[model samples]
Target: MTSKGLFVSFEGIDGSGKSTQARRLADTLTARGHEAVLTREPGGSPGAEEIRALVLQGDPDRWSAETELLLFTAARRDHLERTIRPALAAHRIVICDRFADSTRMYQGLSRGDLRAAVDQLHELMIGQEPDVTILIDMDPAAGLARAKSRQTVEERFEDFGVALQEDMRTGFLALAQEFPDRIRVIDGNRPEEAVARDVLDAVETCLP
Candidate 1:
């Protein structure tokens, strides 16, 4: 089912301000006379929300890499069926805070064989790709610091230590390189407004 809408996803490390930027971008698009739907991964729909809590709060030490990937894919499937695909079908711009990229980064960090995982998962789900993916790149230390400052209670992934988080950041960069046509890496070390503007510009360039 094809539609005249754009799917833009925001990706980044823990504290790259992707959530904030995604909202700003949606508001900007709406102000420009476009219908924009702001949603997020792992919890876009009610069913996905339950899966999200399980994935986020579960013990990381006990969770296998394969298990993590499957849980993420499950949530994503629910999100696509219940939220993303429907919104796109209605010709509304969909801005997601995080999507498949997060699974690649997180699971890729824990598991070495990520290519096969991505291929298999994509083949099973994700019929359509995002028109643009704005990657808010930032240093792992800085990102984690920001996340720590803002959060009162840390989650499982947040407890993965700095090294794993750094690996995840690198993983995101690699994914961006692999899909350069659809991914735009933006230096997220700047002010929030500046980053938001850059994201908006990238989306504008990609969308019709």
Candidate 2:
């Protein structure tokens, strides 16, 4: 079903600051008299939040890649049903920080054939696609360094070593290439405000 509201997603490596840019874009929309719903994947809904904790708790040694993918998909389904869909129906712009794109990147790096997984997920859960997805691109090492410098506590992914982080960045770029029309690649090595401006510009093209 089609709605007046637009669904936009922000995607990037851990320290790319997609969350900050997403919030800024939402604020921009609100200031312009538009309703915007700012949310995130894997924890947007109650059930999703539960799944998020399990997925991010750093059990890669215990969990298989397919298991990880399934968990992520389950969370995404819950998020879609309880949060995204209703907001869209209400004509609110949904600006999501790390949606299916993250799944494609991380899971794709974990396994392979990310396109197939994305298709399966769409068939099973996500009935619609985002109108636009801004990909904040950055060097994995630099991004991870920034993240570590800012954080007081480390997460599973953060502690996964440099190789995995590099894989994730490459995976994201591949996914962006696969969906060029839907994904806008933004250089995230710049200042936060500059990156935010680029994101806003990308979002403007898709907004009504």
- TM-score to true structure, per model: 0.93, 0.91
lDDT of 2 at 73: 87
Tens digits of per-residue lDDT, candidate 1, 61-164, equal 75777887888788888999999989988898899989888877788554556757766786778766788899999989998888877764436777776887
Error of 2 at 97 (Å): 0.8
Cα error, residue 202 of model 1, in Å, equals 0.4
lDDT by residue (tens digit), candidate 2, 124-144: 777677889899888889988
Question: What is the lDDT for 147 in model 2?
Answer: 78
Q: Model 1: clashing residue pairs?
A: none
Best by lDDT: 1
